[model samples]
Target: MEKQVEAIVEWLRQQLKQSGAKGFVVGVSGGIDSAVVANLIKRAAPENSLGVLLPIYTKPEHMTDSQKVIEKCGIDSLTLDLTESHNVMYSYIQDQLKGKNEFNESTDQLAGANLRARLRMSALYTVATNYNYLVVGTDNAAEWYTGYFTKYGDGGVDILPIVDFTKSEVRELAKYLDVPEEVITKAPSADLWEDQTDEKEMGTTYDRIDAYLGGEEIPEKDKDIIELLHKRSAHKRDPLPQYKRKS
Candidate 1:
């Protein structure tokens, strides 16, 4: 584990050196993935990494957990509360679709939820741009493979350092990096919406996802769900579709 951390830290240093960027800006959601990645970047660039906490209608516990990471890692951070902005955008969406009969508050919740993610990404980019830093994403391989992230929202980022690591591996790394125990054991949630949890929303657990991702056999039903998520979210993983034309 120590050697792995050394290699990754060196890789981040090399990437930043070659790109000639000032630093890294990461969004901390009080989740394991974000915490791990943010801390790793901070380790690599102690004076250059900036961890941004963007909360929109977030839970109190989430804020506490995020603060714990900051204290634990001693990483610099700035908090941007986007509750008002989120409300405005969600209201606009609901109002715009109200008369169309194709939308309702109940069914359009996902749109509003995704709006929160986009708003956070926008905020992260704005700060990164001002400081000439890269917006580092916290997505893991399991989430990326299954499309658990919002397209152009959480998926919008300048670079991802741990996209190849699974949830279990992330936990191991987090442990190695001295991540808070509460964060490690806390029910995985994006804190995107009230009462929302990762496993509940995905209808599966990280243990299952990691096992399958690691080439271990799993239940047929679980495999089906995983495959369906991958197939349905294929567009999210690729560049915009376009008509074929000769250059």
Candidate 2:
């Protein structure tokens, strides 16, 4: 783990040099993945790393945990409360849709939830722009494979530091980085809505995803769920579609 840490730190430095960016900024969601990233960027550029906390209808405990991560990493941090921003933007869209008779109540919940993530993404980019830093993403391998992230939202970032690591591996990295115990042990949640959890939304647990990714045999039901998610989310992992001009 120590060697991996050194390698990642060096890689971050190399990326920064290549991008000509001053540093890196990450949205600290109080989750283990984000916490690990915050620490990593801080190590890579102690003076240049920034942790932005964008809370939109988020739980109070999540904010507290985010603070713990910032303090633990001793990274420069800023907090932006986007609750009102999200409410107004979503409400306006809902109203516009209703007026056009295009509002679908069945998909409303998901729309609002994804709006929160996109809002955070915009806020982080805004701050990063001011600092001339790249926005770092916190998606782990399990989340990446499952397409469990919001496109152009949480998935919209300049770089993903831990996208190759599984959930368990991320937790181990968190521990190695001396991340706060509470943040490390808390159930993983995107905090997109009230009382929402990652496992609940995915219909499966990270343990199962880790096992599947490890090439270990799992139950047929679990395998089906994982494979279906991957198939459905293939678009998210693939490059943007392009039009071809041919003779």
Best by lDDT: 2
Estimate the TM-score for candidate 2: 0.99
Best by TM-score: 2
Candidate 1 matches the true fold with a TM-score of: 0.96
User: Between which residue pairs do clashes occur in model 2?
Assistant: none
Model 2, global lDDT: 0.94
**Tens-digit lDDT string for candidate 2 (1-247):** 8988998899999999999999999999989999999999999999999999999878889999999999989999999999999889999999999999999999999999989999999999999999999999999999999999999999999988889999999998999999999999999999988899999999999999999999999899889999999999999999999999998
Tell me how far the alpha carbon of residue 100 in candidate 2 is from the true structure, in angstroms, after superposition.
Answer: 1.9
Clashing pairs in 1: none
Residue lDDT tens for model 1, 20-107: 9988999888889888988889989999999899999899899999999988998999999999999987887777777686676676
Candidate 2: where are CA atoms >4 Å away? none
In candidate 1, where is summed lDDT lowest over 10 consecutive residues?
99-108
Off by over 4 Å in 1: 100-102
lDDT measured at residue 93 in model 1 versus the true structure, 0 to 100:
70
